[model samples]
Target chain A: MNLGILIAGLLTLAIYSFLYKDNPVYRAAESLLIGLSIGYTLVLFWQSTLFDKLFYPLLREHGIWLTIPLILGLMMFSRLTRKWSWLSRIPIALMIGAGAGAAIPAMLYARTLKQVSATVHPLIMENGGFDISAVVVVIGVLTTLAYFYFTREHKGVMGKMARVGTYFLMIFFGATFGYTVMSRLSTLIGRIDFLLGDFLHLLK
Target chain B: MNSNKTRWIIYSTLLIVVVLSYLLGINLITHPSPEVQKSYTFIENLPESSVVMVSFDHEASSLPEIQPISLILLRHLFRRNLRVVGLSLFAEGTAIGYRTLTKVAQEYGKQYGHDYVFLGFKPQHISAILGMGESIRGVFPEDYFGNKIEEIPLMRKIRNYDDILVVISIADGDRTMQWIEYAGAKYHQRIMAGLTAAMITTYDPYLASGQLSSAVGGLKGAAEYENLYGRRGMGNRGMVAQTAAHIFIIVLIVIGNILYFKNRSKGGGNR
Candidate 1:
């Protein structure tokens, strides 16, 4: 058995041992995974982002314009200081403003306008048959939106629509839950494959 | 039985079933869902030598579900002789992306700088996406291995999003939304995603709007792509175990519900 596989197998078993009871073995494995992940991420940040994007530009390319961001990034460290903690807010505000400014128009076109247009498609298809699914989607979107209309109490026709909306919401949630299970199960199957095929050589 | 004992029994049973499914090579025939088929056909119809950017936007934790998706797609792209430019938006995905790309590229006998180039991870994903619209080399001066982008033969032709045919963001989270919003909506890049099963529904609206060209989701999606690619891989094998595990869970749920109802009728205390 390869040493790497052996170590991986041990860690897998250690993590699975938690099903019986939490123990030092599981704790050790958990800590190792967390530590290794953090270490890897820090190195990647330095090599990929900070070193290439920041340091190399400042030193080698002599891109003096890069210092503005450099200063702003450094101001983020003011969060650690008692008196200068307010300085951190400058960068935070800038990030939030820039992010939102960049995001809003795209979100409007991609998420809002496009979604609304899709929902409110032509009731009749080009082939001339009534687009039943399109009508259902339009109704579903309207009723669901109405359900969140808190200004008026849900009663009479509104109550009926809200009830229908609840059913649609329930179906959506159920489908999401089912897929979530499949997602997690796929992860489990992956580990099982690694253990049997890679680690133990129990399977081809 | 004690709840802890019951839990242990359940876990052991689940593990055994999955392992046995793998060992026995249990095959479950599956048809490609429409969404997955759409994604397959999108790639299938791509012109040869078209540049495709694959953003590995996931981490190690979600690798089990997402890796097969990435691998299958990469295989298909390489098989078609497509120029793949790999990059990552997430820090954790940087190394994971490189490893997966390298492994698949080797299997296809692809040269690194000529056939595929990994641009590594970029911070501020929104800016990076926009920057790629202007100049990919400007955003990533150095490839993942610290080689100048200008030196890479593949990178020479690919200057911006316009030069690329499509961008596939294989992700576990909502990073695909950023790709769609910035890269697809703003830059008019054809964007697709290979998402974890849990995230498929979230992108349905984008798919409907044609903002996202298509998406392959979860292990099932990978399996579909593998079938399309005419090769059986981890996706096929993993699906068997997944089916077995799902059946096991369903059986357990039914039995538990039956037992609970029976006990309730007998006025037994909740346990």
Candidate 2:
């Protein structure tokens, strides 16, 4: 057999071995994935951020102004040291604060306003007469939302409503499960296609 | 009449239905050919050269499902000579999307910047999203390759949301909703989503109510997109395997059920 086939077979074996039971081959592949990811991220981050934003300005313009970010970046490395670890918080805090500040208002509008408004759309049709589908969708949205409406006891009439909501929730979950199954099956198919169609060229 | 027999019957019934459905292509409703209908509607509705933001919001993990849709859509956009601005919501998707976009753009002889641009992954998702609307250049000062955004031909004329016609998010998260509120509602930019099959139903209301122009959900949707573009990619390849796998699972369920019911009839223990 050719080297190419050998390598491919080994990789397939390594990946599929996880099904039978976890072993050293799986561990090796998993570790390699982590290592490769970190390495790739470092390269990308350096290319996109550090080299572009940091070194390019300094090198192209000979600007001493680049010292600020350079210093801040160096400070980030200080987290590795036992004594200077506390200094890492400045940049970490800034990143977190900025992330939270950005997420809050955007989430407020997107999750609260747009999602709620989208849920509350006209259930009955206007020009096309009545749309049962639209009414069903609206009810589905409300009931599914109600399924998660905790902080109140779901007892008696409220309990019945919650149970009704739970039914809607189950339908939603069934739909989700169906889609997820398709997606996962697709992934397996893609891999098999690579092995069968692309590589082996079998059964054509 | 026994509890065990009833459970076995339910399991076997479900198995038979699922297998029959897949093998026969039996669907309850003939889903409107999403491939043709959605793409045609999208192309005809949006004016030529309109700046459309396409987010590669999925990862390599989901490439099996998402990449085919990404390629066909890119082909459509490029074929129509649309000014495509690509970004990634998930970091893992950055390289995958960039590679796919570059390959498709090259196929159509689309020049970078003049026809399409990869903005890469915006660091802060929501802020960067809002910032894109507020000031396109300020949020992404440079292109993925580190070229200044102001100098890039694709971005030069874009001052803000006025130039942005559509924001297409293909994500696994609720970030699509973020785009709707921040860009769609805030700037009235037409939004579309190409999402995993699993996330489709939650956003169906958006598609119906005119909040989103259109969307393609999961591998089947991706396959539909591929069919429209006149190219069969991994999505179509995957369908064969998916149908086969579903059949396998259904068979397993049926066999398991048969074993259960037969054992139960013999007064065998549940264990």
Best by DockQ: 1
Clashing residue pairs, backbone N/CA/C < 3 A, model 2: none
Interface RMSD of candidate 2, in Å, is: 4.7
Model 2 docking tier (incorrect/acceptable/medium/high): acceptable
* lDDT values, one for every candidate: 0.90, 0.73
Interface RMSD of the candidates, in order: 1.1, 4.7
State each model's C-alpha RMSD to the native. 1.7, 5.7
Candidate 1: tens digits of C-alpha lDDT, residues B143-230: 8878998889988877899899899999999999999989888989999899999998788778888888989999999998888888
What's the lDDT of the predicted structure labeled candidate 1?
A: 0.90
RMSD of 2: 5.7
Q: After superposition, how far is residue B265 of candidate 2 from its true place, in Å?
A: 7.5
Chain B TM, every candidate: 0.95, 0.81
* Reference contacts reproduced by model 2: 0.45
